[model samples]
Target: MKRTPLYDLHVELGGKLVDFAGWEMPVQYPLGIMGEHKQCREKAALFDVSHMGQVILRGENVGEKLEALCPQAFATLPKGKARYGFFTNEDGGIMDDLIVSNAGDHFFVVVNAALRHQDIPHMRAHLDEVEVTEIFDRALVAVQGPKAEDVVGALCPAARDLKFMETTVAPIDGVECRVSRLGYTGEDGYEISIPEDKAIEVTRALLAHEDCEPAGLGARDSLRLEAGLCLYGNDIDQSTSPIEANLAWAIQKRRKEEGGFPGAERIQRELAEGPARKLVGIKPDGRAPARQGVEVQNLQGHTIGQITSGGFGPTVGGPVAMGYVAAGHTEPGEQVNLIIRGKAQPARIVALPFVKQNYKR
Candidate 1:
């Protein structure tokens, strides 16, 4: 498995390493997953996310050319602003979700590590007019929590001014880095892209803060789950359409009306008429966590859906899950049963975000 630049540091910090998306990543640390999860909720926690794929697109009409690949209105995207979007297949299925940032003359895209191999090639094939350049010289890290401002602001004051989803290039500890005010933990934070050689130094400096601690993948997954954020290949994939995944909010008004992107017809149809299924939050009745692939049945015991991502939410104090269910059963407060370990367990549908998002907006 490929190792990120922080492998040695993870070892030194007593991080439990595990294989994730072909990378040797830390699943948890000596602090434990539950502790790390709470630490991020209450204070600041740093994460090593260098394994994600980062790419840059150049040439004229970069955003316009990019619109052909996704449903976002990037043609009007202002500089220093980043927007979340995804690539769609001809059939309206989501290929992969990504974040695009307009950086002056170019656009920077960050994709999931596991799907980068396919996503990059897909972009090159469809966006032929744009100069697609994969960036391998930078490592990304995130410091997230209520106290994130104090931890990162002490090192770089410019970051304090950035609102949610805003980005900028600034010098921190004498190294210029791209700092974006966004994160996966549903907390106020920043994702910093640093030079590969200086990654360890920058990470160490951030960890040195009294309010910051090092968290791993275990806590990361639980955090996103509680935040109601979708995980690629799990909650969404090539077989899932954006509308079905409840991600229509990412599609802009102009793009929705013009119908120019791939599978625009199907998407427009879904917009006018809801999809057959909808992804919704699930909360089990007991302490037993209903994991992925578990069959979701209506009160009458008829299978209605399947759990995609499910786990114990440290903040929620119970098992939390998100899955696609028949449109009829998507309403909150609806009762359902989860087939866990061959037994039916009672559960209920709830509004998304088991926890409130703490973005600095």
Candidate 2:
């Protein structure tokens, strides 16, 4: 398995290493999943996300060319700003979700680590005349939580002015970095792109802050689950459409009307007429956790859907989950049952984000 630039640092921090998307990544640390989860919620936590792919797109009409592949308003995206989007297949199913930032002279894209091969090739094939360059010399680190700004701002004062979804070229200890004020943990934070050689130094500096500590994948997954965020392979895949995944908000008004992307027809149709199934939050009663692949049944014990992501939410103070269910049965307060271990467990469909998002708009 491939090791990220910060692999050694993670091991030194007592992180339990595990295989993730062909890379040996830290799943948790000595603080454990619960401790790290609460730490990020109440303060700040640093995540080693160097395994993800970072690509630079340039050339004439770059955003226009990119529109041919996905449904997003890239052409109109202002400089120093970031937007969340995904690649859709001919069937309107999500190929992979990504974050795109307009860096004035070029566009920077961050894709899921597992789908870099598939996503990069797809971009080169469809985005004609665009220079697609992948950056292998940088290691990505995310500082996330309510106190993230304080920890990061102390190193680079310029970063404090960046609002959520904003991006800027800044420095940490005089070393250049691409800082984006965004994260998946539903907190006010930033993802810093630093040189591979300086990754450990920058990470160590951030961890030195009183509010910042190292967190791993275990806490990352649980935090995103509580935030009602979708995981690429688990909550969404090639089989799930953007509309069904509750991500229509990411499709800007112009893209929705122009309809030039791969699955425009199907997406437009789904927009006009709702999808067959919709992704919604599931709240299991009592303490038993409902895990992925568990069948979701209606009150009469009829299978209606299945859980895609589930776990004990440290912030929600209970078991939280998200899954796709029959569109007609997606209303909040709707009763359902999760088939855990061949037995029916009572559950309910609630509004997404068991805990409110804390983005610094």
Candidate 3:
């Protein structure tokens, strides 16, 4: 197991440690999950996401190579912009969901911490003449919330002008970094990539702002869930297809018509005819939370699906969850039952993103 550069800082802050993807990480701090969650929603929170893998691909034909490897068309991406896409297997199942950014002469990628090892090899196998460099000694930190813009803007004024899904190279206190105006919290935020040696300095600088507090994985999980974002291993995995996960928008219209990339045929078919099961949001009637792996049943007590992600939504003031249900029963407001601890808890289908997204356009 590995620890990120900020492990000492997390320990100093009294963060409760836990094992995540073979890395020693802080799950929560003394403020607890609920407090950290609120701080992020109300102000700004800093997350040490150094365990994630950052890789750069460079070559004359790197765009074409990436287009072949990913479901999204990288050739159309403009410089200083980022696009979210999935790496799919031959059967149309997702290997991982990653962000691809156009960094002038090279492409920058941020991959999930758990899939870093597998993803690197998979990506390298498809490259013919591209330079793949793993930035192993770098760390990623995200400053997220409504006030994030102002805090980050104070350090790097150029980043304030960046729109959602945009990236720019900027210097913060003499530390060069690639700053992206993107986050999983559905808020106005920036993800900064800094050298491992400067991780503490960058974190300290961000935390100096009165609105910024150090957040942990517990808050991140809740925030992403409230935003209806999927976790790699739980909500989406190799067995789940993009269409089945209700992520059809990830496949651009141009790519759909041109038909390139692996599993294009299967994905196109699903787009045309729809998938057997679809991911949808569910709102539990009472405070009893619905948890993952719980069976989803219809009014007649017949199981229709299983909950993939669920928890008490602080913003919503109730329990909210997402799961894959048979397509026929996925309509919003449809009556459903969640079998929680052998008790059939009544629930209803609802629109996703229980909390409204506040992304700055």
Candidate 4:
């Protein structure tokens, strides 16, 4: 497995290592998953996300060329703002979900670690006469929590003024970096991109803050799950469409009306009518956590769907999950049974985002 630039720092901090998507990543610290989860919600947590990919696209009509490839309208995004959307195949299957930022001279995209290899070629093939540079030597880190702004502000004062989903070039201890006000935790956080050689210095500076503790992928997963955010392979994939995943909101209004993106016909039809199945949040009644691949069944023992992502939510103090079920069975308050440990555990459909997001607008 590959090691990130912060591998040594993780070992020094006593991070429990695990294999994640071909990378040797820290799964948790000595504080454990629960502790890390609580710390992130109450204070600030720094995450080494150097395994993710950073790609820069440049050349003439770059915005117009990329606008056709992504679902989000990139042409209208002002300088320094970031947008989240998917690169879809002609059939509407997701190639990858990415965060794109308008970096004045060019566009900067951050893609998932697992999809980096495939995403690079896929993006390049579709973009004509565009120069794509893969900055694999760069390292990325995330500082997330309610007090994230205050903690990061002390080190990089410019970050405090950035709105959610915005990016800016800032200096950290003489190292040039791109600080973006975005994170996976549904908190007011920032993802900092720094040169490979300067990563350790910047990470140490953030950790020096009293409010910041090192968090791992384990806590990050639970945080996003509680926030009702989709996990690429689990909640969404090539087999699933954005409409079926209940991500219609990610599709802008004008794009929906114009219907030009990939799989637009099917997506538009589903939007106008309704998908056969929809992703919904489920709250289990007991301590038993409904895990992925568990069958979601109706009261009459009929299998309606399957749990895509499920686990005990530390914030909610209960077991929560998100899955797709037949449309008629997706309404809030609908009762469903999740088969866990050979028993049919009682569960109910509830409003998404089990924990409300506290993003700084």
Candidate 5:
């Protein structure tokens, strides 16, 4: 497995290492997953996410040329602003969800670590006119939570002025770094990209703050899940359309009218007619914790859907899950049963994002 530049630091911090998408990543620290999770919710937590893929697209009309690959209409996307989009196939299936930032001279894209091998090649094949370069000499880290702004601001005052989803090049510990007010944890935080050699130096600077603690993958997953964010392989895949995945919000209004991206026809049809199934939040009664692949059945005992991601939310103090169900059963307060351990457990459909997102807009 590939190891990130922070692997040795993770070991020194007594992180529990695990294999994640061909990378040796820290799943938890000595403080435990729940402890790290609560730390991010209540204070500030730092995460090493260097395993993710970073690609730079440079050329005239970079965003316009890249729009052919996804459903987002990047024509109106302002410079220094980032948009969340998917790399979809011809059939409207999601190849990978990515963040594309229009950074004046070039477009910066960040994709999931597991799908980098496929996503980079796919982008190159479709965006032949644009210069696509994979950046491997940089390390990415996230500082997230309510206190993150103050902590990060102390190091880089410029970051405090950045609006949500806005990005800029800022210096951290005297090392120029790309800083963005974006995160997956539904908090007001920043993702910083710096030279690999300066990763430790910058991380140490962030950790020096009394409010910041080192969080691992375990907390990251739980945080995103509680935020109602989809996990690429588990909640969404090549077989799932953006409509079914509740991602229509990412598609711009003009793009829906003048469709030019892959799967335009199918996606438009689904948008008009509605998808057969929809992803929704599920709250199981008690704390049994319905897990992924658990069959979801209606009150009448007929299977209606299955759980994609589920776990005990440390912040929520209860079991929270997100899954797909028949469109007819998607209303909040709708009752359903989850078959767990051979017993039918009562569950209810609820609005997404069990926790309120506190992004600094």
Candidate 6:
């Protein structure tokens, strides 16, 4: 397994290491998952996300060329701004979800670690004449939570002014970083891309601040799950379409109307006709913590869907889960049963994001 630039720091902090997406990363620290989860929610937490893939796309008509490949309307994306969308395959299934920022001279892309290799080849094959460079020399880190702004602002005052979904190259403690005010935690935070050599320096500077704590993948998963964000392989995959994944909001009006992407026909058709199944939030009556692959059944014991991501939400104060159910049974307050340990546990369909998102727009 690979190691990120912050592997040494993680070890110093007594993080529990685990294999994730071909990388040996910290799953949690001595603080544990719940402790780290609360730290990010109530205060600030820093995450080592260097394992994620980063690429730079530069060339003439970059926006126009990129719009053809992505499902979002990249042409309208202003410079120094970021947008979240996925690369869809020909069958309308999600190839991979990505975050793309439109820098002045080039577009910066961040893809899932698992799909990093496949994503680059797909882009190079489709984006003819575009210079696609994989940036392996840089390491990525995310500072997230309610107090993230103040913690990061102390180091780079310019970051405080960047609105959500905005990106800019800024200097933090003399380390030049491509900073984006975005994160998967559903909190007001910034994702910083810095030189691999400077990663430890930048991280130490941020951690020295009293407001920040080191969080691991355990907390990261719970935070994003509570935010109703889909985990690439768990909640969404090549077999899931954006429409069915409840990510239709990411598809702008122009892209939905123009229909030029790989699965435009099927995606647009699903948009108009509605998908057969829809992703919905499930709140169980008790705290059994319905896990992934658990069968979701109707009141009559008929299986309707399956739990994709489920766990005990430290913030939600109960078991929270997100899964796909028959469209008709997706509305909030609808009753369902989760087959846990061979017994059916009563649950109700609730609106997504068991906890409300706190993005600083």
Clashing pairs in 1: none
Which regions of candidate 3 fall more than 4 Å away from where they truly are? none
Candidate 3 global TM-score? 0.98
Instruction: List model 1 lDDT by residue over 56-139, tens digit each.
Output: 999889899889989999999999999999999899999999999999989999999999999899888878678889998899
Q: Tell me each candidate's TM-score.
A: 0.99, 0.99, 0.98, 0.98, 0.99, 0.99
Whole-model alpha-carbon lDDT for candidate 4: 0.90
Number of clashing residue pairs, candidate 5: 0
Q: lDDT by residue for model 3 over 54-156, one digit each (tens)? A: 9999888787788887878788899999999989988888999999999998999999999998999988888888888889888999999998987888878
* Global CA lDDT computed for model 2: 0.94
Candidate 5 clash pair list: none
lDDT of 4 at 241: 80
Return the number of clashes found in candidate 6.
Answer: 0
Q: Which window of ten consecutive residues has the lowest lDDT sum in model 5?
A: 122-131
What is residue 104's positional error in candidate 3, in angstroms? 0.4
lDDT tens digits, residue span 1-361, model 4 = 9999899999999999999999999999988899999999999999989889999999887777787877778878899999998887777767789999999999999999999999899878888998999997889999999989988888788998999999999987778999999999977899999899988988999899899999999999999999999999999988788888878888888888886777777778888998889899999998888888999999999999999999999999989999999989998999999988778989999999999999998
Residue 107, candidate 2: Cα error in Å is 0.7
Instruction: Supply the global lDDT for candidate 6.
Output: 0.93
Worst 10 residues of 3 by lDDT: 61-70
- List the candidate 5 regions with Cα displacement exceeding 4 Å: none
* lDDT of every predicted structure (CA atoms): 0.94, 0.94, 0.90, 0.90, 0.93, 0.93
